[model samples]
Target: MINYEEILNSSVVDIKPSGIRKFFDIAEQMENVISLGVGEPDFKTPWHIRQAGIDALEKSKTRYTSNRGLIELRREISSYYKRKLNLDYSPESEVLVTVGGSEAIDLAIRALINEGDEVIIPEPSFVCYVPIVKMAGGVPVIINTKAENEFRLTAEELKGAITEKTKMLILPFPNNPTGAIMEREDLEKIAEILKGTNIIILSDEIYSELTYGNSHTSIAQIGEMQERTVLISGFSKAYSMTGWRLGYILCPAPLCKQMTKIHQFCIMSSPTVSQYAAIEALKNGDDDIASMRAEYDVRRTYVVNEFRKMGLSVFEPKGAFYVFPCIKSSGMTSDEFCERLLKEKKVATVPGNAFGECGEGFIRVSYCNSLGNLKIALSKIKEFLKENKNG
Candidate 1:
């Protein structure tokens, strides 16, 4: 047999495969499984967004767009940023569109990290950050965000993780799985720590439009930090355009130049029709977002309150669409708890450790499903908890 290991890069081999995938591999074969495990919004792209793509096709605008994306699309993106986040970027030089928020993240790290440099990432935030940092030839130093602090990376935590070789800090709030976010004051504290340091900030604001009570804050909004931060976002979460794979990165001029280099060579351009659709999204997707967020708020209350009524310790998520409920009372590890729940109750959710080591005693439950589905899942969960209760 061919020695595949000999030919592959060991760096890729060393990374652990996503823990979420194992559950998916099993769930795919089972019948009657209700998944609260998924991360994407269940809504289809709003009709107008789809109509824009169809309109583009009829106009024969199917050819490759500029490597940085269509001019009008980038212009709309810049406007959207200002209107939504109070940050400014020049459409001409600061924005580079990519396949998804995932690609924007990879390009941001790759464009900046040098080999042996360390990238500080807040966890349990997202699974992609660690492997992407390593894949970009940088060392990933994961900074644990404590649940006590609502999973916001405190200034002390940022300072504690910084070493002489620290190259970048990934701020992943409205954090995935945990649904944690940082307020302006918290971000300012972190900015103060890095004020004189060389560490770049990669702020993933994909969930910027989904914050419950407070508007999302960007680290780039801090004085003097705009030059050092790369803001990443997309239409996937807010606009329910997940499958469209449209995302953009806003960086300093020099950094955008560097990312476009990789983007040109690796991906020539983002999907052409998607770019056209995204222009419409930036222009008119706010109504869609408002409606979706309003609906999520309702479901969020139901799922979170239902779980609390079951006597499980539940943290009310302030942003994103997930809740991290502690499974410690069941006397089972995250994996053990999720496995038994799936097999016995037929309700599917991801174990918290799938996010990072800090996620150990929790399991992430997505509220993206319909109320009918959620009611069924919660009823099943209550029954399972009654049997498994150690009290």
Candidate 2:
């Protein structure tokens, strides 16, 4: 047999598989599993968005777009950002369409990091940031955000993690798994700390459209910080366009130029049909976002209340479709809690440790499914908790 290990990149080999996927695989093999594990929206792409993709196909618009993406789509993205977030970018120079926000993040990290440079990541946030930073030849520096602060990365935490080697800081809010959001004041403090530094902020705002109570704020919206922030977003969560694989990155022209080079060689451009559909989503999808957000809000409330009633300590999530509840009260590690719950109750939830080490005593439960399904999952979880409660 060929020595595959000898040929593989050492860095890639060292990275472990995603912690979320293991339980998902087990659930997939089981019958009648009520999964609260995956972070995808249960909603289908809104009718108009789907229709636009269909129309594009009917018109035979299947060729590759410009390496930077279709100009019209970029322009729509520019206008949408300006109107919704008060952030401005020149479409012709500062925007690059990507396969998904995943690509945009990869491009940004690869373009910016040199070997041994340190990239600070706040967790439990997203699973991709550390590995992407490592793949880019950068050192992964982690700052474990606390549940006491609702998992928002404090300015103090950022300052503590920074050193001469620090090159990038990933800001993922409204965060995944934890469902934590950094409000304006929280972001302002972070902006202040980063004001004079060379540290680039890779702000992943994929869940921006899902925030409830207060509007989502980007560090890019802060004046001095805008020049250093690469803002990434996609249609996956908000518009239910996950399979369409369309996303974009907005950065200062200089950074955009570098990121586009990586994107050009690696991806060339996002899918043409998806680009057309994304344009429709940006222009005519406000009602769709509102409808979905309202529905999620109901599910969010129900899930939080149910978890609390079970005597589990769950921080109220203000955004995203997830709730991270402390499983410590059940006297089990996150992994044990999830495994036992899956085996006994037939409900699947991702262990919080999938997101980071700080997630050890918690489990992430996504509320992206229907209210009826969530109710069933919650009841199953309640039964599991009762059986496993700490003495």
Best by lDDT: 2
Name the weakest run of 10 consecutive residues (lDDT summed) in model 2: 382-391
lDDT by residue (tens digit), candidate 2, 44-116: 9999999999999999999999999999999999999999988889999999999999999999999999999
**RMSD per model, one decimal:** 0.9, 0.8
lDDT of 2: 0.93
Each model's lDDT comes to 0.92, 0.93
> Per-residue lDDT of 354-388 in model 1, one digit per residue for the tens?
99988999999999999999999999999999998
Clashing pairs in 1: none
Off by over 4 Å in 1: none
* Clash totals, every prediction: 0, 0
Off by over 4 Å in 2: none
